[model samples]
Target chain A: MTHATLALLTLAACAPAERGRTLVIAAYTTPREVLSEQLLPAFREDWRRRHGEEVRFETSYQGSGSQSRAVAAGLEADVVWLSLEPDVERLVGAGLVTGDWRGTPTGGLASSSVAVIGVREGNPLQLHSWADLEREGVEVLTPNVRTSGGAMWGVMAIAGAADRRGADPLRALGATLARVRVMDKGARESMLSFEKGVGDAIITYENEVVVARRAGVPLDYAVPAQTIRIENPAAVVDAYADRHGTRDLAEALVAFLGEAPQQEVMGRYGLRPVREGVDCPDLPALSEVFTVRDLGGWEAVQGRIFADGALYDQALSLSRGQR
Target chain B: MSVRWGLAGWAITAGVALWVGALVALPLAAVGAEALHRGPGPALAAVLHPDALRALALSASLATWVAAVNTVGGLAVAWALVRWDFPGRRLLAAAVDLPFAVPTLVVGVLFVALLGPNTTLGRALEAAGLRVVYAWPGMAVALCFVTLPFVVRAVEPVLAELDPAEQEAARTLGATRWQVWSRVVIPPLIPPLVAGGGQSLARALGEFGAMAVVSGNVPRETLVASVYVLGEVEAGQVGDAAAVSLVLLALAAAAQLAGRRAGRWLGAA
Candidate 1:
């Protein structure tokens, strides 16, 4: 029995390499379900037809910030599809990604969305714009900016809306944050809290709301007139790809994500297509949209707002006293 | 012994040493080395940072409350299970260990489902001006659930093994039930209770998954040391995370040592 067990273990270990190549994609948790269910099957079929062999995938999904750090700490991911640019930049800082990845195929953007208010069905609170979040007794749910890349974008979107309205951005953000009932560790968890009736509304990615709606969750989300456009970047981790001799496969997968067919699948999964002509009807139209660059890019935004003891910390301290 | 026997003995010793070194010593050494990578001053500064200090205080206070409650509650449970013969007694004893079988994250989810803002009980509690979820009390509740098995399991066997004749003798000597319990029964239970309380406290101090889901991770409010370490790591501050982790490890070590020493001293007395 022992000898037979040893033989089986050795065979199982050696089976994968003998079958075909394996690609490891580490992604943030929000897009994982759609990727596994919709995107990966299509990618696998196309890759097999092109290469005349089967290609298996190993996927790791985590909060965007944590996932980025895991890859940076040698998670051996061939491709990283994360929610924000800074997360990808961490790979650059770790020497895992070479060259200017943001200027790669399709400008390194795989999909796009915007921050929106996810409210209860029928919109009982009458929450329409960012200003409605600051009204008295209207509790909000958002993830912690320190742990969730999406939360940082939500804060930036709120600050941008405040700026567009000629309001004091710090005061506006402070008031809204004051009304936050709970800050979950990630965007998905915050949405779960909202679904559990923990808050009146949630500030989350537009795709999150769309995906929930498609899943038949009783949720109604409103796209504010002024909001921050959320762009999710995809890149091949050059160090891991070269080490595993899967560079061509990794690059092909990322490029395939930008292709029209895959873009349409992404749109169907509630992500806005990077290509202009493809439209997802579930996505609400936006009147005014701002990118990270409008707030002087991620570097400036992180420094001014989300950094330790910066605006976010100060605002939280001030609001803690009020509560 | 022959050379072959000596070689086998040496091989066995080497295996044991390797197991201990890899599983226990290596991880502790790695954390200490990384924490002190930037020198002791910076590591100490990171640990002593205001938010970290607050988190430490909150974790310690919550763990203390959890330990206190578990000590009293676990004793009552063990006493009833051992000293009584009632309907569902076996089932009640088995239910005490439910927290051990359930995953900590699932426990957090269950707490949310039961007491979240949307539930009927939750709404009633909120109307009564008491919030459970997303507050410090929610974290304490999660910790209590995860650490419930520690004290009960520790004391149950000792209680079972305790002689009923000692109590009967005290009662025959004209002692009341309260006096018999306080004089004869309580003294012998102290050592195990203290040890169990220490283990429960340690578990609570290091708890992350359940508390992470329930505590809201608010800075200087609901955030605990473990979650704070995670937030630091997420922010790409590995050095800070390592330093804070070492602080928690040190605290757990100190607490366990103090608890064991106190238990031994009390037992001797």
Candidate 2:
């Protein structure tokens, strides 16, 4: 090896062991990271003062479903702050949580909206609502709903669109789904992919669009006539936390997220408050805009849209036969 | 035997075996254990998911084509590097390794810059009524870029070790150039080619970065098995994701076995 390489290797050998009291956390994507880094440290300090316990977060960021699966598969999470409600329901089903979570925890944290169509700067399609996505040359892009929390919301929004249209909406959706040039696996991946010119428009969360726009991505979010409100649910993994005797602290942290201090952090990340009147300049206030709700729970949604993966099969068959 | 040395050797061997057992065997065991869950129903269902199955089929075909292309192209490039005295020969050698040095994500981004709708080449292609960015062709291009090094690195050293006297002797016997290559030169290169092809297949199958940046991750058309497994995991279906991964592992193992059998058959011929 070269001298520089040898020296570098020698320096690496002197690295210190990890320190601090680690709190294992499972969260979904960008919002979780911002919450942990910017918000949680302050909360941790507060907990130390009140309870005389020191804890630092060691977190993993993944898709909502994936995080839920990890918990199901015994990933040993102290707390799970997820992107949607259905994921939390899985934990309850697994018996990791006790009773209804909304009654047990610090109220509930649920105030985000599902993805909307984010168009190019010029608005070339003259597009509005889910129907506009069905137009030819539209080239829609959305994170795969099967994997992303935002995608769950997006699926609800699509289903809501079908409901508004009445009679038949899948036919309209299928055509729009066909025009989608890319389906990113996650929200951030979708953002980056969209910025790289993969498609004419993207369907992602309003907050993601705000973040992207702040980063100077040439995109604009157009809220359709009806869109789903993203109901993000956070809860202390009761059995795990109670076993560790961190229950009081865990309750406090979850409660803290419900109040104004946590709202400030969510606001910075483009997450609208779950309740009304905690206004931020850039984001749409929760009360003003019309956000749609999914008619079914996670299971039903998965069963209809993503369970069989038929859509993917059709898309592949179409592309393969072409080239 | 020296007592001190013997004890040290036994301890060292035990330590190494234990480390390997923990690192590799445990994960493999977990996969096997999980595979046995639901009596193979979940495993079969996971692999049979339309999106995953499509990705599996697409990834396999793409890997095969990419490996074949690399085999021929790599051999030609190795031959030129060894047999010719072109200007900037050293520079050419460095350039051949360029794909390895650059990150795969950057390679995908580079293609986007060159062929995206924003670029002149993109406009030209657009005018020709052709699309390259979000198509199967783009995926092939990305896979080719990442796997380019394997075949070249495998063959180059082997080709260098080959003596020139064998080629000269064949020519002296009035054998044609093609005859010399087919009968004398191609035989020993089989092992390295198989090795390179296997490595390339593994790399191409696991590839996510390039496809993520360039091919658009469109369902079925561009969603590779790795990305699809990730999608399942993200959907809060660990059992399904693990099942998909188990299926991918099985497919990879089968491909390797087929490659070995083909190598043996070619060697016998």
lDDT of 1 by residue, A292-314 (tens): 99989888988998877787777
Q: iRMS for all predictions?
A: 1.6, 3.1
Lowest lDDT sum, 10 consecutive residues, model 2 chain A, at A285-294
Give one digit per residue, the lDDT tens place, for model 2 in A6-52.
88877664342122345667877757545755668888888778766
Which prediction has the highest lDDT against the true structure? Answer: 1
Separate clash counts for every candidate: 0, 8
lDDT for each candidate structure: 0.87, 0.73
Please give the RMSD of candidate 1 to the true structure. 3.7
